[model samples]
Target: MNDHCNRCVGCTVQECRHHSDCEDFCTLDRVQIGTHEGNVTMDQCTDCKSFDRR
Candidate 1:
């Protein structure tokens, strides 16, 4: 993807397929965010449902 195409979607997970190859960002137009907990109260409860292993 072009620099601008995914630059706005900041990320740090190196294992995600959508993560930029050369930058700390995601290459998807939109990302799916979800939770694994019934009653979430911490950041760890959230997840990037859009994630796909590289």
Candidate 2:
């Protein structure tokens, strides 16, 4: 991976519009992470609310 830009250490979400090709890193300054309201018990329940389409 290339240098970490913004706060992203690394990312594989190439579909995101803010994803950089150089390092496979997210260029966004920050990301919003959240969990579902009803019965959040596992890692699958968490979501990256800041993901935008390319």
Give all TM-scores, in the order shown. 0.84, 0.68
For residues 1-54, write the lDDT of model 1, one tens digit per residue.
425337667899989778877889888999989999999999999999999987
lDDT of each: 0.84, 0.73
Tell me the lDDT of candidate 2: 0.73
In TM-score terms, candidate 1 sits at: 0.84
lDDT for 47 in candidate 1 is: 96
Stretch of 10 with least lDDT, candidate 1: 1-10
Question: How many clashing pairs in candidate 2?
Answer: 0
Best by lDDT: 1
**What are the per-model numbers of colliding residue pairs?**
0, 0
- Model 1 bad stretches (over 4 Å): 1-5
